[model samples]
Target: MAVHLFTEWSKSPGHLDHWERTGREQGEECGLPNLGQTCYLSAVLQCLYHTLPLTHYLISQAFKEDVVKRSPSRGQVVQAAADILTEMDRGKPKKGTLAYFKGVCGRMDDLFAGSGQREAHDLLSSFLTWVHQDLSSSRNACKKCGLEPERRSTISDIFEGIHRATIICPESGAIICSIHERFWSLSLPLNNPGETPLEDALQQYYHTRAIKWYCHYCRREHLCHRQMHILFLPKVLILHLNRYNIKGSDPKLNWVTFPTEELTLDGHLTPGQKGRPWSKFSLYSICNHHGNKKRGHYTACCRSNHPQHVQTPWLFFDDEEVRPIERFKNPRDAHILFYIGVSQVQQESRQTCLASGGMGLQ
Candidate 1:
């Protein structure tokens, strides 16, 4: 009987095998159609899809429930967007998803309608804001006290940072410290015209500056040194290079060199927080802008997660075309960089801290 069953199973059609092969091929080369001037949207979506944890969260059942329970109207847009991306991830591509996303955007704002190119950074900001508003839950238990408390939303904090202000009085040698805890992204200014390293740019951001200060303690004015510090570092770090200056519309076409592997932030972490030691991240995605101020194109390069590959593969997405690239041809055009936590211990610690209701700039 066993032999007979085995013979019949072996003789059955290879439909399952064929389907698996087809799915693998499709998933390896999935691309989004250029819906008019929606390349900005496409670039952002591709980058988001590459963020494995975010993709997993979006496609999870929890996200579906949160959307329905929250704002159903605006939530539907996020749901639709997530659903479309989920389908693509499952190797079931839908061209109509782009259309649906566009329709939702149009209904939400008039600025996103029609075939006009928009800034990719602005689109990412709006998308993140919408997603954060809809899916964020307040019921997460605190890891320390084991009680639910009024805390910062996990979704928002994943991308948020702290801006610290320090004032010093020269005459009395008095010092004051203040912290402003909210920044979605870090704006890094370039020094040279052609090239700047990521570390250098970050150093420039936290560099000390001399400012005129009125010391209330001393009741006098004095020249004081001021400095900014990163009070909180998010699990996913998004760095935006300030290429477009206020002087003119022209963008700085300088090559901003960034680490392709590990990005250590121990030096940038807040003083007390530095003892925790979870300041390393792995580069995952990059959004590059081509052309100048008048007219430009957006493209994204993302790390591909395939079990067979020895080294992580980086694939370039230009509109509807997807191709594997050894390295970014033009690193200067890199406008947005995404990095995710790589240390498991650090990740667990962060989760524990968030779960314990210790969610803040510590």
Candidate 2:
């Protein structure tokens, strides 16, 4: 399959230059036409587009090379995504990339076809899997030895973590432990019945759990414990709240209070690792769902990098319409939240301002 470049559109007499100039003048608020019931996908895309590292990577030459190397025939989703990012960066009107993305998604799953409304989390998982397939690699070696190139492969380490399971024998008091790396998004359960704080939910997620198991070390049945810990911090952190309860068909609308400025993850890290003392992150975007499971609307709010704004800026994207907001007063409907490291925010802000030609403040 031949690769299609955004430059192909440059043939239309200064279209690309005009788009760039307009974007520099006005803040980027490129909208997307709703492809039937693709609001979920659109919301996910909006949040991901606001992710600085992800947006930068998608438009980078390395991403294109990786797409060609990993997915030769089925690279339309990625290609379309990149084109959308480019168009948005240039401050162009909505060109509608939903058709391309929907086509690829339908090929993967039947539920994604037509005007059927799918879960945002499910679509996000599929999209991330497709995009980050060949973006990372793993190394296998002993504690003393260095990396083993033979075991290396494409690996995205942003959401990676380790799951540790420990088994203790009741009779002999012997203990057995095992640790393994996990590459996936973290789903935090709303265990508490009433309103819960985001930090409290995270604590519950990493809290140790005891269960009955057979201990191989002492060859006897005993109690076992399992815990999860962060292996390393990623440039962008995505957290999905599991709101739907199995017992009750209704979705949990309980308020999940999350930090707007900073979230430290020092307690979740594994011991003896040389990772940062505290993984601090600042809110960048939020994917919120309104109404119930059967009928609902998906919308997203992203931190705006427009240099002209006096106060902190945020834009809410509802399908083809975009509007600015001060901040999220109520976070009850916040389903998926995106955060980036504080250290990188300043650099990204500078890039955003430079890209926009340093527009005058209002």
Candidate 3:
């Protein structure tokens, strides 16, 4: 199964067959026997990559449940597995330790301590350190203050970091600048710059070759660039409404209604707004062109409009260029540096997307 998932069977037919026949010979040699385990771990890490809601302890217990249900580990193996997962959940496990253990168990060594246990322990230790280093980025605080109190001190950050790390290969120096190229083309709202970190969040991708690219909206990383898609407002609006209660009374309250005019085919690109005095929903505008001369026009209230006109044309639509679903040709093309820096709110879930108006990129 691991071979099937990871290997390009059609591209390397006989090679896959050979590996499958030998039962993951390469993985075994690399100390990972179970491709399924690595796949599972990768999926979990990616899920947590989006947002980690469960506590480390709870995550460990969940892993125990999964492994125990599959194997007749009596309580000993279950307990040991739980311990290993616990260390991983708490960011103490080494790089790929969970997947490695899943691969090496029963094939390479025993877990009853001694050399086998020591190796396992070392793996877990290394994983944990990596998790800490990657996820635990330090925020600068003033000499008199603990400014980064809102930072999430958990393993999720590391997962995101790791996901981001894939695109960067120091050895090859291969890069894709897709995000950077579309930087001006895409419209996004800005937030307080002081609260967001600016370093290499999106900058590193400026020119590095990326083996895989994650869709920000879907939370699935390691995706082919061609598979990427800009989010449409309708779905994004729903997600925001459900998550943040967009319509209900709040300080950020703004009305976002559907279009009275027919939808267009060509999408619009309204410049994103920054600072206050502007509703968050008004930040970016995306209108699909419906092939009509007046296709791009939609209801909207500008500063000059009175309350009645505001309500009348409050619904805005757009018609601009639609970005193709392509792998960022270079890292800079994917560098949402300004957007990320302006929008990163430490207190909010990292995965949470802000609500935009009708015909907007949700």
How high is the CA lDDT of each candidate model? 0.65, 0.63, 0.24
Order of the predicted models by lDDT, top scorer first: 1, 2, 3
Mark the regions of model 2 whose C-alpha exceeds 4 Å error after superposition: 1-27, 68-73, 93-96, 134-155, 163-174, 306-311, 344-362
Model 1: lDDT of residue 328: 40
Candidate 1's C-alpha lDDT?
0.65
TM-score rank order: 1, 2, 3
Q: Could you give candidate 1's per-residue lDDT for residues 1-362 as a string of tens digits?
A: 01100000111221111111111222454678888878888888888877655665566544666663454355866777778787767655577977888777766667777889988887788777667766665656434223334334435645655555667666666676454545777878664676778898899888888887777886667678786776556667898877775455356546688875457877776666551234477677899898875678999988775321124457889988988876444366898999865554544554565467542221
Top-lDDT structure, candidate number? 1
How well does candidate 1 score on lDDT at residue 7? 7
Pick by lDDT: 1 or 2, better one: 1
Q: Which structure is stronger by TM-score: 1 or 3?
A: 1
- Model 2, CA-based lDDT: 0.63
lDDT of 3 by residue, 1-362 (tens): 12311111112211111111112211100111223323223222222211212223234353333322322333333343445444433334444555444444343223322322122122322333333332343445322222222222233221111011123323433433232111112222212222222212112222234356554444455533321222111101100111122333221222122221122211221113122111112111122111112111111111111111112122121111112212211111111111111112211221232221212121
* Alpha-carbon deviation at 1 in model 1, angstroms: 34
- Tens digits of per-residue lDDT for model 2 on 1-362? 22111211112221212111112233356667787777898898888777654565565544665554445235666677777776666566354456776777777677787788889998988877666543433456524222223232222434433444445555665656655555456788775566888899899988887777777875766667665676556545788988775456455546588876557777786666544322466677899998777779899988775322223467889988888775456457898988755443444554476467653222
**Which sections of candidate 1 miss by over 4 Å?**
1-26, 68-73, 139-154, 211-213, 220-223, 249-253, 275-277, 307-310, 327-330, 344-362
- Candidate 1: clashing pairs of residues: 142-355, 142-356, 142-357, 143-355, 143-356, 143-357, 144-356
TM-score of 3: 0.19
